[model samples]
Target: GVPLSTNEDSTRNQNLAALYVLPQTSYPTFYDVRLFIDPGYTEAFHGNVSIRIIPNINIDQITIHAMAMRIDSIRVVSDVNPNEDLFSDFTLATDDTHLLTIRLTRNITALQPHVIHIDYVAQYADDMFGVYVSTYEENGRTVNLVTSQLQPTFARRAFPCYDEPALKAVFRTTIYAPAAYATVRSNTPERRDSLKPNEPGYVKHEFEDTLVMSTYLIAYLVSNFNYI
Candidate 1:
């Protein structure tokens, strides 16, 4: 039986959580996993990424998830001759979720396209940002508190993709998480979100996209958190 346990190492656990190991079959073997990126804010962006190809695989299905942003265009710049623009036949809009899939029609001679580039902006959210706290008092007053992992849930929540790390993609996430929240985190250290004053219970968190990574590895936890 496959071993199962709660993940402890934040980094290693994040990678493991993003992967799905399937059972062996009688014939050929292939694995299909979804991928996502948070293109924070950039006019032009480019990235190179790689994925380990499992032996005995015949094909790979590549899908891109872009939601709530304007995708002026997308083009396949490598791997194939003639540089095909595959985005035309692809689906651009989802029920508030944007998902596009492309089958690698040809065998890959090199690891490319596995690294993708994206350009987009981060929009604001009403429900996407908020403070939910659980508190208790020592003597009839409240003291303890808790906050949401709004980065993965709120920030990326607006968009739809694999939303994990093992399915790493060159993520370029530019958006507003919130202002009251001091810090934000992504797969890469590219840019930071800006803060501005707003109505009650409102702020902004704008950051740059992330590095090449699986969907699940894309994570952010915001709050006054102290790790032991």
Candidate 2:
């Protein structure tokens, strides 16, 4: 035999129900029951059940590439409110050619509306394609020259980010070089453009704003690389 009771709570618009079952057989038997609990069952369950709801957030794709040098490391600085770190979750790869990928972290929910800063270093390799360097034969004499126009492909061969024409972000770059190189160019106009005072052979150049662009769209060139 079973006894049932139902009551309605008008204030909360909830139905509270209870059921009592009495054993009719000598042996215990299993029974299948279904309970249609209200959507707001916190009070009825006395807060014993915990439910977690995650919001739907959009994540942007990022990619990177490196050129002319081997990338030793990549660092990602998160802009979380409590200052959380997100460097450990990024994926990095590099071949002798210019290409890298920065896979987004799975828990990108924590990085909503935040800026990520990436820093890396690369070493110069001999230009096999003569893109960054130029060669000319004058009167049967061999002349070798370097040019800055190869920045789009050569400079970007360092780290992975968005690498298309339209996908762009604000970026700041500082280039280190020997004392002879005096000129550097970036997509954005220079702001604090100067050489490192104490450091003899390093030039610290910065840009103010960058147009929306892909990672490959970023370009920089350094010539006669010298410090102050």
On TM-score, the leading prediction is 2
Q: How does residue 22 of candidate 1 score in lDDT?
A: 22
**Residue-wise lDDT of candidate 2 within 1-228, one digit each (tens)?**
685443535433432211111111111011111111111111110001011111134432333343443333433333354265444444444444344443444445622443334444333234532124435566796543333333344434333333233334444434333334455555667665442232343444555545443444454454543331
- Per-residue error at 194 for model 1, in Å? 21
Error of 1 at 132 (Å): 16
TM-score for candidate 2, residues paired by index: 0.47
- Return the TM-score for candidate 1, rounded to 2 decimals: 0.36
Worst 10 residues of 1 by lDDT: 25-34
- lDDT per residue as tens, model 1, 77-108: 34444455333334554554444443444543
Clashes of each: 34, 22
Could you tell me every candidate's TM-score relative to the true structure?
0.36, 0.47
